[model samples]
Target chain A: AQSVTQPDARVTVSEGASLQLRCKYSYSGTPYLFWYVQYPRQGLQLLLKYYSGDPVVQGVNGFEAEFIKSNSSFHLRKASVHWSDSAVYFCAVSAYGNEKITFGAGTKLTIKP
Target chain B: GGIITQTPKFLIGQEGQKLTLKCQQNFNHDTMYWYRQDSGKGLRLIYYSITENDLQKGDLSEGYDASREKKSSFSLTVTSAQKNEMAVFLCASSIGRGTSQNTLYFGAGTRLSVL
Candidate 1:
């Protein structure tokens, strides 16, 4: 069975620091990768996605993720973080052309002001 | 912008009682899904619908029933609420399956508590 793993349970970074949240996926074929963020008491919001061609994908809120096929990793990143960037980040993977996504446990990001 | 709405922001029920949660999407998406989120666990799929009147069981569909009344609405019912059960029920929708282009959109979610 295909699965997604996010190793970190929580991460804390200063307001001006950079951020990286790791994600790894297990699948047989090419994977469709996605990053989603959930704010407190809010729904999950799409941050970015990677399908084909581009290994580097940009998302909303100045976030981007690089899909590294070799290591089965898709890590989310931001050049500089802000105070409002605190949220739980989830990494998801889908079988090629399948809509059913397997999500990671998620990493809670806390921005220290 | 389109929106997904889940009714009853918070639900409280007694053990063994039947409870239902409703979801509506204005995006006209062909697919809708229901998921459960525990305090520290990832979202678990419960049930889904490909279109109106079409239902599919997901990984965690046992003990739950789902209904797609129409293209714009879907409802999930707990067959029998269990005591000490507490989780967040989320409703989501997407245009189609296959590619990352069809991103899932979610509602605020309905928090359920059973005592």
Candidate 2:
């Protein structure tokens, strides 16, 4: 079974500060990785996804994630974050041909003024 | 652009009572999914349907039942509500089952509270 691990349960950052959310995965073969964000009382929205191609994939809101196969990590990063970016982030993994996606225990992000 | 709608934004049920949550999608997607979200734990899939009349069990399908009578609708039922149980039920749909087109579009969610 493929699984995702997000070490940080909560992350606090100041507005306009650079941010990074680390994600690690355990899968036997090639894995499909994704990052999702959920606002309070709202369903999740996809931040980005990595299947194949270049290690780095760009997503909405100036967010990006790099898939490092050797380290089995796909970390999400942003040069500068805004207060609106504060939300719970989840990392997920799925097999190549499977439709079931396993999500990590989400990390809550807070933006300090 | 398409939208997924989940009915009964909030539901309160008594212990041992049966409750059903409804979902409708206008995207005409071929796949629909039901997931349960708890406070600390992330989303856990309860059931999914590839097409109308097709059902598949997910990791957390034991206490739940799902039906996909139409391509645009999927419904979930809790056989018996547990006392003091609270969680958010999410409905989602995708274009197809393949890896590339599996980006799921989700509904706002149905919050369930059992007394």
Candidate 3:
């Protein structure tokens, strides 16, 4: 079975501090990973995705994620976060490009000013 | 640039009443999808269409009927609205439906409430 695990249901961080949202997946075949962000009263927006190339993929709003095959994880990170960055993040896994994706429970990030 | 538009931003229907939600995308994408998001439950796929006149069931398609009358429009119908049922129905379109990896463009979503 293929699945995504977002270990932390919620995380809090101070504004201007570094932040990391962990995500792990279990799939037998090669995995295609993606991170999406959803703001309150808004639709989901794609953050980034990882495929065959570089382990670290950069996304919009100065966000990036590193794909670790050995660890079965693709965690999202940002050097500094603002209050506006606080939102719900979802991690998804697929067989390959444009295939059916299984998503994690999602991690809610809270930034304290 | 393309946008996915969902009609009836807010809908309130009676129990056992059949409700319909409409979606239209101008991206010329091949696939369109309908997903339901509960208060705490993650998004659940309800129905998807790969192209014009093609309908595919997702993990949570029971009780829902979808239509792909044209390449740019897809609609979903609630067989029988349940009382006190509340959920947000999201519409998305992508180049393909086979992979989760495909970047999906979503609409603001329709907030549904059954009385």
Kept native contacts, as fractions per model, are 0.46, 0.51, 0.63
lDDT of 3 by residue, A1-113 (tens): 57899989899999999999999999988998889999987899999999778999999999999999999999999999999998999998877643466678788899999
CAPRI band of model 2? medium
Native-to-model Cα distance after best TM-score fit, residue A111 in candidate 2, in Å:
0.8
Predicted candidate 1 versus true structure: per-residue lDDT over B9-84, tens digit per residue: 9999999999999999999898898989886678888887877898878788998999998999999999999999
> What are the per-residue Cα lDDT tens digits for candidate 2 across B16-63?
998999999999898899999998888888998888999989889988
Docking class of 1: medium
Provide the lowest-lDDT 10-residue window in model 2 chain B.
B95-104
Candidates arranged by TM-score, highest first: 2, 1, 3
Best by TM-score: 2
Report the C-alpha lDDT of model 3 over B35-100, residue by residue, as the tens digit: 898755667788888779999787788999999999999999999999999999999988884555
lDDT for every model?
0.90, 0.91, 0.89
Q: Which residue segments of model 1 deviate by more than 4 Å?
A: B97-100
Off by over 4 Å in 2: none
Q: What is the interface RMSD of each candidate, in Å?
A: 1.8, 1.7, 2.5
Worst 10 residues of 1 chain B by lDDT: B94-103
State how far residue B87 of model 3 sits from its true place (Å).
Answer: 0.7
Native contacts recovered by model 2: 0.51
TM-score of the candidate numbered 2? 0.95
